[model samples]
Target chain A: MREGTGLPAVDLGTTEMLEPGTALLIPTETSGYQEDIGLFRAETGSYYALDDECPHEVASLSEGWIEGEEIECPLHSSRFCLPDGRVLCLPAVRDARTHRIEVREDRVLLYPGTAATRT
Target chain B: MSIESILVIGGGLAGFTVAQNLRARGYAGALSIIDPAGIPYDRPPLSKAYLLGQKDTAGIALAPAEWYAEHRVELIRGTVRKLDTEYLGVELADGRRVHADRLVLATGGSPRPLPIPGGDLETVLALRNKEDADVLREKTTPGMRLVIVGAGLIGAEVASSARTLGAEVTLIDPVDPPLVPAVGQALARRLHAMHLDAGITLVHGTPVDISKTTHGHSLILDDGRSIDCDEVLVGIGIVPNTALAQAAGLETENGMLVDENQRTSNPLIYAVGDMARTRNPDGSLERRGEHWEYAMNTGATAAAAILEQELPVHGASWFWSDRHGTHVEGVGDMNGVGATVLRLAGEDPIAAFHLAEDGRMLGAASIDGGLTIRAARRIIDRGIIVPPESLADPGIALKKLAR
Candidate 1:
């Protein structure tokens, strides 16, 4: 059973959450687009979720490496700032879609319908 | 002194970026870009996506047409015949002299011509602008025999696209390994193998002459072999458009001389992009950078300099090319910079990092490993020291080393 904190939530299994500095690619449906979402756990315990696809080549961003607040796509050096999903480098011209995330009762919950929370 | 009016001579990526960045930086001055091309679009896709019909012309626009009007940046489609340095203006071919308080030169570069007889034949072509690309798209057909004169990024990608379009491509270069100087030996070998796997004919020979035939042209090689093709694309290199700078009495050698701040001999005038040979931050001479990132970087630096703001520091020089459906990006000094090469671990895709003796990352080249190269950029920029064993490990996230 999953508990929703006033938003649509998808239970990612309590013990299966990725560690900090790592990301997980979880398929989810958004209001505008339906695709896999990349959920990242920062070193500070905060969570961020963005579209899994890199806009430049449509490569999976879940395989990307995350720095302070940026995600570098694995296929090409296209980078984007987290939370707001602002483009930080070239080869990728569009911004990734950032979704809302929350940890509800030891389980990772992703709210895909919420508006993007800008950093 | 305030810059009330700014005129950018060139409407390519460099020119377009400067205009947009100036406005983004809150400059209320009148900005105008003058160039021979009507619409300013990106050029990277001309050899890959656009040529292969994967991307259309509209996909390459830097900014929508309405963006210029909204930003109040005037876009003029015209060619400049002369640069009037005294009045800080440009003389157009139509006898119009447009003056500005400040002038920025972004006249990128022109394709180098093949030094051989019959090189300018109708069937022979070179891709530099949209017109050249359009001509190539028209001639790219199935069963067509295409011969490329160089094995640089442009020629290699063009071969990839031509192969995708069902054309038989033959790439001829004087060097044994074409991309060794740019991407090191290992990655260059991979690319060479990739091209061969895609059925592209690789020939190691210097082109001596081009003879026109009834069907097409025959390219004669110094090795006493002739390659017959329906079309010839000479992607040897580029020659910077420094004539305007030379005529304006600005110092010019390999290119128009400029400082790290993109400042030319005259403080009122500035030159950036492929046409400008920039000086290092410490006043050392640097050759002109032909990469698109260099154009954008110099454009932003010039805008910041005009606003009297602090100049941004450039990190590792980066460039990327697509071949045989694989995207390869090279960052920093791929000449190895006397550093040891370490291949990073990944199965689907791989990357090679160049680490200096002091444990500082010097450069990286990757196939489908753009993230590693992006992380490697910060390591090289910050001079971060990481153990070679750690860099080779797949478990260790390279970005964490930046801290």
Candidate 2:
């Protein structure tokens, strides 16, 4: 058994639901959190998670375009690095909050309220 | 010569971006921003979120006080009397002189006054800065009759926001549906029709005169129609503030003339933001960009030029406006001569794209289609030749074509 971080890990369905270079939103009710969570799969077949809300406005990051390891906010074009949620552009000075995601044998699991382990 | 200290006039987005980019690029020399407004805040929200009471003064600030202190950027609150180019310094209105090795002019534009009778009335309002928005917000009350002239971006946004505040808004414009040049005719028509749905009365006429009335004001139109309202807002456009540049012997034609690097006629001085117009190598002046993104882009370019670093490359021009609970974004040249392809969903225009004869995407505009616009920007930047059928088909996601 893997050592637990005390927080509940949510199975976000199968990895097949999220193809390479695509993203999906985990609603607040499903994530058991107040804010929605965005799970993105880069073209390199890596998974990263972040708060769905763009730090600049009320836009959902899940709807944003994903290029490489950065996600460009649909509104105002503010880009955030997927791994650490660092702001890569202007109009948004604050960095977004990132969450941890793990793909355990084709099953995607989300550790809500936990910081993403930097790769 | 190495730049030891830099001074920027006008603490708007352009000036703030210059300072911000300078620090980000590791230029640790002395930097300062001087403006009549003490702190730099965003202006786009002034006619929308800030006016609607959704955001406070602190919310619109470009950066917090701590950021300025941490970055060691001095924020000076003063008005510039004149530019002492010989000494590479500025003379404040209070008789104080601040010297710097390099000078940047980001003095943005001022609201263009209506050129008609009683147009300059004290009660006639214009939204440019925070104080203007605060005053407009205070006057915008429930059931108050408000008449806004010029249904452009700012006027339309204010009308929508005022209606949300329960005010009776009447918007006036010369054109049937304004902003055809910015967002194309189809998208502009869709956006303009939203005013009626939101309970804003649209008036297609020019105001010939504005007279003070007992109850409020009477705006006389060229068609001999008069609109009586408690308050009036004129948002036609802005006149670039080029007086300082003209007095300092810099090239000024409608705006301060600058090269591709944002450098003015005088090598020691540079200008950015709305006040600076690019003069091509052939001596033709390009249209001055007055949008927020253009200001930020020019500031970044100016910072790099000042530090002798490689200039940052910016893509096509982009702008966005919010009204009637809908977000409209457009990128590149929407007015280019080409065929227009519109993507509609159940009779509503979700996105409209312009394509050249060779199928190259020229420009695109969309309502509540942020993802579509983002993809369109990439397609335009990369010069992607997408078929018209795929662009018009709502079933086919634009993101796929962008790849």
Candidate 3:
């Protein structure tokens, strides 16, 4: 049993649906947040969650390409550091809001509204 | 030569980027940006979000007011009267002479005025900056009849935004379906078709004249057909602000001619963004790029060159436009010689990919397919050859092919 942070942890289902180096879009209803959450699994097997919307324009970050620990927004190519949601490029100066994510025993757990701090 | 102080003219994205990158690259020199508009704000949103009242002036600002103060960048509010190349500075229109060790010109461009009669009327509008957007926004009202001249990016965007604001928009253009060179014919057709669907009257004719009417304005097409509208907006294109560059004797054709490092004929001065046209080593002048990303890229290149640092590698030219609640993105040279492989979703064409004769990807354009365009940009940049079958298949993910 993983220690909970006292916040509501929504089980995003088995990691089978979210393979390594892929991203899964958790809808607003599932995340219980106003905006959708983007759940990304890096090739290194690290899971990170961020707001699905790109800060620049009306773009879904979940549809963006993932390279290493950065997610490049498909629209305008504004890249964000996956771990801390730091903006890595121009056209987008605002940092994206990141959510905490933990994967235990193939079960992906997402803490909605919890800030993902750089470990 | 030690560049102790740097002066940048124009406060658009290009000028702001040069100043921003200078600070980012740890050049703690006396940096100052002079512009008629004090702060640097984004222009792309001026046509869509800003005009539609979705984004405020602050929202479209390149950086907050505190950013300049924090970065020690002095923002000067004034226009440049003359470029003093000998003094390596500028004379402000207000008669203030400011000197710096290095001078950067990012003067950007002004809206291309209509050549017909009544085209230059004060009532006729054009959107290029925040002030222009504000005026357009104020004039746009429900049931207002608006006629936009030019069906290009800005014209089309204003048409879409005006329609959203409950205005009856009539978009007139010389070409039946414009922007074929930007996004290719297939995507251009689809994008132009959206105007009709959005209740905008698309006029396929050239405007010969604009005359004031009793109620509003009347635009006479080449065929003598007239369009009556409450407001007229001209979004044809832009004329580069090269007066300062020309007066200083820096090479200028369509725009200020700059070398690979963004250095003009005079090494002390540099030019970037829409007003700076790159001159190839073989003496061929590249077209001046007016896109937002191109401005930032040129700014970055100028900054690196100024700091004696390695220039940042830029990928294929990319641009995006939002209209009718749909996002369109294009990358690379879509007009190049290639076969277009279109990915369709049922009856709708979602993505179009241009593949070269040698199997390499030349360019791509998509409607509401940002990811597809992003992947195609990577493929084009990396010189990756993708199978046309896989590119056309909607089932196969574009990301997979990029890898």
Top-lDDT candidate index? 2
Which digits, one per residue and each the tens of the lDDT, describe model 2 over residues B236-344?
A: 9999998987888888999999999999999989999999999999998899999999999999999999998999999888999988879999998887778899999
Looking at model 2 chain B, which ten-residue stretch has the lowest summed lDDT? B330-339
> How would you order the candidates by DockQ, starting with the best?
3, 2, 1
Candidate 3 residues lying further than 4 Å off, grouped into runs, are A1-6, A11-17, A28-35, A103-107
Query: Candidate 2 local accuracy as lDDT?
Result: 0.91
Docking category of candidate 1: acceptable
TM-score of each: 0.91, 0.97, 0.95
Proportion of true inter-chain contacts also present in candidate 2: 0.62
Q: Which should have the higher TM-score, number 1 or number 3?
A: 3
Candidate 3 per-residue lDDT, tens place, B1-403, comes to 7889999999899999999999999999899999998889988899988888888988988988998999999999998999998888999989999999989999999999999899999999998988888999999999999999999999999999999999999998889789989887777888899999999998999998998988889988899898888999999999999998898888899999999999999998999999999999999989899999999999999999999999999999989998898889888887778788999899788888888899999889899885888889889999998989999899998988998
Error of 3 at B178 (Å): 0.9
- For all the predictions, what are the DockQ values? 0.37, 0.64, 0.65
By summed lDDT, the worst window of 10 consecutive residues in model 3 chain B runs over: B330-339
Q: How many pairs of residues collide in model 1?
A: 0
In model 1, where do residues sit more than 4 Å from their true spots? A1-7, A13-16, A28-33, A42-45, A88-91, A102-107, A117-119, B280-284, B344-350, B392-403
Say which docking band candidate 2 falls in.
medium
